[model samples]
Target: MDYGIWNVIELLGALGFFIYGMKVMSEGIQKAAGDNLRSILGTMTSNRYTGVLTGFLITAIVQSSSATTVMTVSFVNAGLISLVESAGVMMGANIGTTITGWLVSLIGFKMKISAYALPLIAVAMPLMFSKKPNLKNWSEFMIGFALLFLGLEALKEAVPEIQKSPELLSFLTQFNDPGILTRLMFVGVGTILTIVVQSSSAAMAVTIVLCAQGLPIEIGTAMILGENIGTTITAELAALVGNVHAKRSAKIHSLFNIIGVTWMVIMLPYVLDLLHYIWPAPETGDPNKFTLALFHTTFNFMNVMLLIWFVPSIVKLATRLVKSKGDEDEEFSLTNINYDAPLTAEVSILSAQKESIKFAEITKLMFTNLKELLNEQKQDTRDKLKAKISKLEVRTDEIEERIADYLVRVSEQQLSIESSVKVRSILSIAHDLERIADIILRMSKDIERGNKQKSIFSEKQNKNIKEIFGLVDLSIEQMITNLNGVYGKVDISGAIETEMAINALKTKMRKQHLKSTEKKEYDVQSGIIYRDLFFAAEKIGDHVINVSEAVRGDFGKDDEDM
Candidate 1:
């Protein structure tokens, strides 16, 4: 407290830059890897050990266990990863996180490293100036690493001066008189900092560096505990914007970390003693930061080892922890179509395309409800069908929002050239799908409004409309299903069939409209509703054709206009 106020300001400012730099670095790494990290982690389901390794590699590359866990939770929500599989990945993430601690440890003590840090700036500057995104990301990594070391050095240098201050020394002495409550408080501090920062690696990195530089063990351990709790905040925030399953996945991550940290805190003295025993180098002259890094790594690895067998239990616990207080919101549940995972978002898009088709199938139920409205003469039955149709419409809107949001998040991220193209195609198709949703809603409203006027399609008109609408449904189903397959792009023989049939249907419907008009089939109001319904249906088909074309890579004129 008695240290120079200016020095204190400098220390805080340096630490702030360090935290900020780590953030930039972590985000760059994540954006660079994008969905590829999810894909890699998603593949490790059969073997627990393999999953552990996958998790580690992904977290190491991503530079944040919280990000990895949240991504894993997103995957879980999408049904891409089983709970058991996720646990293994989570385990690996813990161990992988140690890489940063080791990296920080290397940077913390060696004064000569700062010389290289300056060279990193020189090397990175050009890369930052380059036109390439990859190069920019490389620069970002460089600047982040440099600032990280710079901050740690400032903190270490600042600490020894504060060591002479009575107020700070007394504060350190108060915590050093350790016991169970004190350790829990320490864990509490770690959890709180991690929660606040949403970055476990940052918290851990600082803890290792500070402890190695002689911040008392009690203080360092408290901060580490806070880091674990803090990591969960990232997943919690992500899940809030996500669905129930996503929330549950985050819950699993948080629960597991809490469990690990809780037990570790209870066993604090013993665990710290174990680390000291395992690596006797820390107590020697010029304390080894590597020892701290090693301790963090092993503690998490051992926790994962101890708990992985109980994955099912953890899953059950997480589910209860994240229980829905009411019925699942259909809109969010419908989002089983996950576009972002450890795998590339594009690959996830392909996977989501399949899920979208299922949504289409669910959509066809709207037609069935419509048909019931047509056949039933009773007001009660009609009202019930109308309500059901309305409910279905609401569900579709929710689905569209969920999808658009997910894709939007993916869109904002750095994507590969190929992935970017795929995303464009996917976005185009999603637009088409969303348009179809519009047509469905319009159709529902039209039928209800038309029914109010008591107008029936004449025999010939009825037959033609049903036949054409049936074809429209068939084409859309095929289009959505084949979107990424041979049927999706290129003239998968069906393209010709689809184009011809849609054209014929359009022509046939046109003639039927002419005949209805010639016959003076109904009142002006009835005719207007009929015409609008027919026009809406045709437009839906047109959009479907365009989507299919977009899927097939026929994007020249249309996209250029946009």
Candidate 2:
């Protein structure tokens, strides 16, 4: 049979639709689920076992390992999880991805299931039309699920024509030419195609279709193997713009997949024999779809069982391989970089918490330095403190850019319904953090001016300022440390304490301002200095309140501190 240009075009079109539908569906699911991803992930303990379990559970729900890994990176970037915890999450993601293979196997054989997809689209389209976000998410999920089925049908239709074409069949045969070298070539093609498409499931789907259409099992598995390695590129790409720690996490993903696939390649015959034992060729039956599903599951499960025990060695090897260069501070390393293809819900929450910690630390330090500047009772010391505050302002800008980039990637991770809400929470927290940093910078600048003019506040005013600073400093430290832990159902007491101190300071400062304004005992210069101090103090108080509001999930307007 001479398959013409139109047939190939049809095949391509079907593949396109199938991929598009899957993309749509994954996004919708993520929209539905991503908010909880962050909080769920945030709750993972330092224990690697639990960390891996968290990763596994999230990926299972999202049906995408890339989504899980990406979320892990985001959490890490926000400093929500330690590197070890992130790695465990990545491991769990690998296990979770196996579920898709099972679902595919179960569904692929059903000729009638295609009918369900259309109704799914119909239901989803209406929801998509709704103004509500939840409705839109539901609509998207249906539409996406429908498209996937339709695309599969198209893929099957597109296959038969190509199967009949001698030219196309012959070309494919070159890779299936009963030689190991040819098999490896096919593996390379599969890896490259998946990498290009950025979707292992799509690649897997295509492989299943080919196998269903009577392609050799050996050839299909080779492509699947390639896909495993191909998927790692996403994590690596995520780390490219991220800090060193992120790069490290991505590297581990790549190494883990590559090494596992390599071992599979070396023991190819044994692997095939194992598959054959598990799924013997049906003597009377046509190439059974169940057999295909079995292979996919058994292979992945075996890999997990084999490698899960080797987690320590894998970690050591990956860490040593991606060592940081000298002169590099680990603190600035991309510890929190995420690898999710799109940010999932669980990750968003984790990312938000991480960002809050960083923001809190910066704000606390900013104030502490300001207090020192006020106390400098040494011109040089005051100058150094001033310079540090200016540096901090620049740092806040960097934090925004970095965290925002990570969040955008999180947006891509195909989040879960619950995880999606947490993502929003995280986003809200990040904004509060940036705002807090800005206010702190303003205070820094004010303190700098006072130091330059060799000005001092009245004895009473100085004592009050010192008292306020002491309270804020103590609260911020507790807030940062507690933010990283799980006592939650609620935020750190720091959130409430921050509000209380700020309110007290605002009231006291207002009375002082009234007295100063009425008496006019100070000169014009003194009045100007006094006014700057009052405004700066008020701004700091306002920022702390803004932070508390964010933790409380009150995204209302910033609370003015008197």
Candidate 3:
């Protein structure tokens, strides 16, 4: 009866504390286990079922389904996983999130763990300041674990006892009427609560505390269902900056949860009776939150069981709902990465690697465009090719800048030895790819200028150019294969052979060009263009070798190439 504005402030403060603890704990664990998480997501999602299990394991480890979903969206955006696989993972994440409810119920309500909060902080202090990254990360996790229980304890003290406050009890009871409308209204309440908090786990914590403080079990159950639907908002928001596939993956998460919740709401009364029959509410000590936790787990587990078989159908619906732009060019956009959230060093480096591959692929396209420009006889077609090459060149510059920025951010984090090497290697590879694009654009410009000035090449000179173009294509193809292959597993012997052939061809072209110029076989301007073109192709070959070297983790060691 004495509840006031300060009580509301205390309640809000406790909620913020709980949410912050969840954030810190989740991030700490994720940063510590990032590589393992990447490995799991990459290797285990071969099918829908495996993806679900992968998602559940990851969510359970990190203790937040939102983090798992966001990571899933990132992977989909990177083209690392398929839509059906993502659907399975999202389903698994739903079941995994119920772990938090059970934790709060079994530990927070049944035990006085908050009594150890201060002692836990004291123990973590030394590790928090450790020079080792792993130690420091785990220390943060311990501190977060302590703070979560402390926040829960504060929440218990902040909420007024519903029994003593007859007025408040009367207000809450109005929504506890045994009707479908009552359940639906409470579900809406839970949904709004989760959306406002941006954390289903935190919302579940609040719901558990309320139930413990005399709120009805049925009302809490409805809210838990709403929280399931609410949690999908994280994935949707995460996919906002992603590509079409990422959006579709997120759509499947929303569709799955909404459909599950729809069926559950209709079955709410029967489910409640069954739950009560199975684990009747206790009359004593901190109202039985176990039933609420049980409902949370069973609902999600059953939902996954019912929906796993329909992953393909879910993917189809999502794809139809979120259509790709008709003219979307994967190379022209940074589809593999986003800056919306802070990613661990491992995840960040992986994103940069994928983007760098796209950067290399773009240079290959520019080379093809240059060849097209050289062959086009019509003035209009040549102009168009020139414009296209110029556009791609500009885009390559932008892509390189973005990848550099992303890598720099990744480098700022505490990285393992391998990840640090990868960051540098990706940076070097991106630089070389952008340089190749520059060379291609310059060659295109030279050809355009020659055409404008009526500086026609001799048959022999054209043949040499065609031959060099073919060699360069071979080199670029090898570079891409190296980029796509596992790091440090590349066979640069093929790249070396191609590079040698290119160099030998460039030397031969130079010798023939000198003889032609000496004999006045063509104008000095035409001879100069031929030499420049061959030299540009040779330079691209050099950079392609550099890319292969970087892929093999042998970058910057060879002065001749570097």
Candidate 4:
């Protein structure tokens, strides 16, 4: 048997085509059902069982458990789902991945689906050219589905017949012993193969092909288990640059698979017997393929069943494993934003909306800190509070930039009119929150200047300033309420009234301050600083109104109070 360099290249190319086709198909489904996917994930994972079913359904639809796991991790990172729920989803994803194995065994090897790839593509081409977005997406899905099966066929053809290639079979035979050590060795090989290819489904296809080509079912099963462990590498890599929670989610995935593989390795023979009992292999002609598929499915299903009760324990372990740094260390970064998830424009808008709400909360905290900064009389405490405010301002700047960049990229996608409006609203709200942070920071600086000049406010002046801060805080609270959809409808009436009251208070304070300045109650410098602080505080209220208007999606409407 002469297997040369070109043969290796051809096999690699076929694998690449298969992986690429899977990606195309998965992305097409994501684009077509992105909104529904978001809704399903957001609403369906109420408990572990539901989470498992959600994970299974998503993986089945996307045809890639890796995609489902990655998306689940992203959801956790974004705070859309909890780690415990994600654990169940990850478990179900393990089961969902076996669908690929069953697919290969039932149809891929049993039929000549690739022969129809060209005709499928031809039939889908015109739909691909359709002006309607949904039709175009469906055509893309069909084209990718055809290409995927075509690639699978090519992969089967590219690998030289194991019997004809004595050297290759001989190499594989080295790890074919029934000892535990041999099984572990093959598991390592499987893990490495999956990591190299970056797709467990592709690895599964290769495993099935090898089994069909006379590789022992036991050896193939060992590799299949290895693929389980190997598949986790994707989530781990994704979490490397993510936040603490993202890392925890990824760790849970790794621990879940590794632990499941460990138990299966210990009970390998019994598991195999159970699989045979459930669905006995044919007496002859490559029963290993079916056997391996059943093994993959049973291994994952049993793993989920065994571990479902331990979800809290797993989440606790993961939380302890990945500790959070201090507040300063947890600066804003978009590394965990998960741009790689196949989110449609509509779904992406939901994430952006969540982030915008988070932005509002952060700004509200900044304002609370500003109040403390103003009240602090000790030089050290005031300086510390000022520094904290400065840090928060910098963080707000980063959040705005990242969120804006994310929304801009989302806007570039094929968005519906409503999604486009939501994107713009989120962008506006982010910008407004950022400006509010900036104004609060500026007010902090103005307070510091007043303290430096020994320009103490009179008792009445202090009362006026505190009153304005109170009104501004109320406005912020209302803005957050609107953003949270607590009422399910955008109502700006309260926000408008609050903004008007703030403006009227500022007017009255300005008049009293001007009279006091004329009477020489305080120096001109003191008056100027007083006016600056008042103006800055009033500006924050204006920005809060802007955020509310953005949330209401009525930015063009004139304020009735104005």
Candidate 5:
């Protein structure tokens, strides 16, 4: 009866502090191991099982299932990981998040960790002032860690004692009845609480604390199940603006948890009995905290075990649920790089690198179409091909703009020297790829015009132009390899050789065309078309070499030669 609005504000403030501390700690860890985290996520999630473990480990370390799921969704959006693999990771993330409940129960509630919070801050302050970047990051982690426990302590004090608050207890007792409807109601309460907090870990802590304060364990278990369902909302929110695949991954996460919760509700009594047999609550102290922690862990582990075999089915169901619109739907979109998610410079750079590679591949496809347009003799086919090439040119413009914007955004984040340099290189590569697409589109249009004007190249001239196209194609291939980072070093020698070959071929062909024109073998109109094609091919080769140079970090070096 005596509870005031200020009490509610104080409680909310304490919860905010806890969430902020978790965020700060998660970010510190991400920054410290950003590169390594990228490598692990890139290489380790090759299969469903490994993917699950990767998810588990990342969530465990970050202590935020929401972060893990969001990262997983982003990777799926980026095409860095498959939907099936992402499902495994999501499952593992659910299990990993249970660690927080155990932590809160075993340490935050049991020990006087808050008393040492200031001392930990005192120790971290000196390291924060250190010149070393790693030290600074570690100091930040320690500070967050201290703040987390301090907030936890404050939260414990802020939550009113339910026994002393008869009116509040009576209100809560209405939903504590032992019935299926009551369990569902409690589950809904848990889900809503987690959605409101946007953190299952925080929700779990609140649930555990309430149970410790004499809330029924059965109701708390229902809340735990609801938290499981609610936690997926974070990933769903992240994937809303993402691609179809990302949406499917998020859907799969939701389905997995929801289905698991549904089954657990049916078998609630049996499951709780099993959990209690394995890890019984204390007789004197708050048994509910221990019971809830064990229940949380057991529920996730069981869900993963039950659903791991159904991953393929889940993937198929998700795919069917979220259908792609069509080819236009596949147009270049930045799904993987969520600006709202906690971003590290290393991860942002990786996303940019992948986008750059995709940019190169798109340009290569445009060049292939250009080559097709060059040889097609049928007017209808040529027109259609021209339209396709023109569309691709527009798409390339979009890709370039998106990639550049992504890189610029990434550069705005705190980046290391190396990451900053890489961002610049990627931006340059995107620009060159865009130009290459434009040149190919121009070449296609030239062919269209030549066909319309009845100024076709002679048999011999067409053969020579095809040869130049061949050389340009090889140069594009080399540029793609450079972008893939397969060479491990700045090996621009092949690019340089291809450039020299393109130049020599262009000069020889131009001289031959002039001689042919002088002999009246080709008319002035035909000569102009042939020269335009030759110049365009040579320009494409130049752009390819520029991309290669950017990949090799030699963007401005030897500008005269380029």
Candidate 6:
């Protein structure tokens, strides 16, 4: 055994190089595709079959099934797609992953693509400095594509030939028997290899290169099966931080792969025979790489064909396997955004938008509770309502901070003009919504203070305050609707009209309060409380209208008026 410690390091380094190139390439394509990629995933996954196609297309374009699966998990986590839809996408991702094996065979082995790596880099370097974001993104893709082939060539050279590593060959030769146990063992090897590298594609490449260096195709095929099982771990790990739905979605991927691998392992010998008969391996240079690639593709395609009919069943099983956290499940958490692995800027903006909508709902509840606090007569009940209002205000502040932080991270990335606008809209909306919560909390405190001082609103004062509360409620409802509705399609006029109504009511109440002050209808201290409550409601209306305006992407339009 001439291979030593440095040889192992060299091999690992080559693997690292290959994985790095793949990562850069995947990110470049994702960035370049931008909103168009999001639009595809959003629109095309209407049904199971279309979802499959969508998954395949995205994985192929990005050159990483792990990326596609994680993206799917994030979507499911965010509630953007249902579990059934995620199942379909995961199925398609399995098939899409085989593209890497084919690339390793057809282009990587047969062609000298690495020879042009330098020239590609040369051309990409100048474009990297372009003022146009699109141009810069495409240039990044070019550089990554070049790096990928160069790394692949490095991998091919770094692998030790079996003839040169007789000890390793002798050990591997024991697994050459066409027995089920040997097949299973190699499958385990493949799975471990994939996991160790954290990339099924890289694992597949290693299997191909090893086979090319004289390892039997049967062993190589078994390893490929293991790789299939191993790739699902990435999605599973990604889902760990996600919700129960996310966990279920990742389970679907694992179950699909595990079931496919189980049947394939049983039928491995026969399947290999069939492949050999259909596409005979060439005599020289371990030609079974093509056969292995074909088997990878055919196995996934057949698995999908057989299981697409049982997607509902798969979803049911996944649901059973991963239970929800019950009360915690419905708590206000970041369902849409996964800060652990930030998606593309466009996709992230969509996540932030959903979170903002939830924030709007929280704001609505805070105001609703504030109204309850004012009219709540029982001291115990009022204290509880006040406590709840305070808690909600704190929650709104935390939500604003998190969403803003996530958006700021998204902004740091290269962004399109439209995505940039979206980020700003969500930020402004989140800020205003937080402000509304603050105002509600302050109003609740004022109401509590007046109660402690033996000052209460008269019947007429209560009635007028209720009228203004009704109007503020209307404005909050509209704010929520706008947050959930389409951005450009927001009916700003209705929101503006609501703001005007709130303003008009506030003015009317002011006049009435002054008249009462002159007539001594209520004590000065009570009048001051009434003035504070109505003015706070008016301030809430201002913020509520600001949210709707942000939804319309109309920032700074009525700032002076507000």
Q: For each candidate, how many residue pairs have backbone atoms clashing (under 3 Å)?
A: 20, 47, 0, 0, 0, 0
> What lDDT does the true structure give each of the candidates?
0.67, 0.67, 0.83, 0.81, 0.81, 0.83
The C-alpha stretches of model 6 lying farther than 4 A from their native spots are: 44-49, 78-80, 163-177, 277-286, 324-326, 330-332, 335-339, 342-350, 364-392, 405-427, 443-534, 545-562
The estimated TM-scores of all candidates read 0.74, 0.80, 0.83, 0.82, 0.86, 0.81
For candidate 6, give the lDDT of residue 530: 96
Tens-digit lDDT track for model 2 on 14-69? Answer: 98988788767766765666446545665575666787778777777667787777
lDDT of 3 by residue, 467-551 (tens): 9999999999999888877676678899999999999999999998888889999998888888999999999999999999998
lDDT of 5 by residue, 347-422 (tens): 5566677667767877888888888887888878888888888887887787788777777777786654445567
Q: On residues 166-224, what C-alpha lDDT tens digit does candidate 4 reach at each position?
A: 77778767755477888888899999999999889999999888788767778899999
Off by over 4 Å in 4: 43-50, 71-82, 163-177, 243-245, 283-286, 319-354, 376-379, 404-429, 453-534, 541-562
- Tens digits of per-residue lDDT, candidate 6, 395-455, equal 7887788888888998898665556777888889988988988888889889999999989
Scored by TM-score, the top model is 5
Worst 10 residues of 2 by lDDT: 553-562
What lDDT does model 6 reach?
Answer: 0.83
Model 1 segments beyond 4 Å from truth?
41-57, 69-92, 107-111, 129-132, 160-177, 238-247, 273-278, 282-288, 321-323, 328-385, 392-431, 448-501, 508-537, 545-562
TM-score of 5: 0.86
Instruction: Give me the runs in candidate 3 sitting further than 4 Å from their true place.
Output: 44-47, 74-82, 129-131, 170-177, 241-246, 276-288, 323-332, 335-338, 342-349, 372-385, 403-429, 450-471, 474-512, 519-526, 545-562
The deviation in Å at residue 286 for candidate 5 is 2.7
Question: Worst 10-residue stretch by lDDT in candidate 6?
Answer: 328-337
- Name model 5 segments beyond 4 Å from true: 78-80, 166-177, 330-332, 335-338, 341-346, 407-413, 457-468, 481-527, 545-562
Clashes of 2: 47
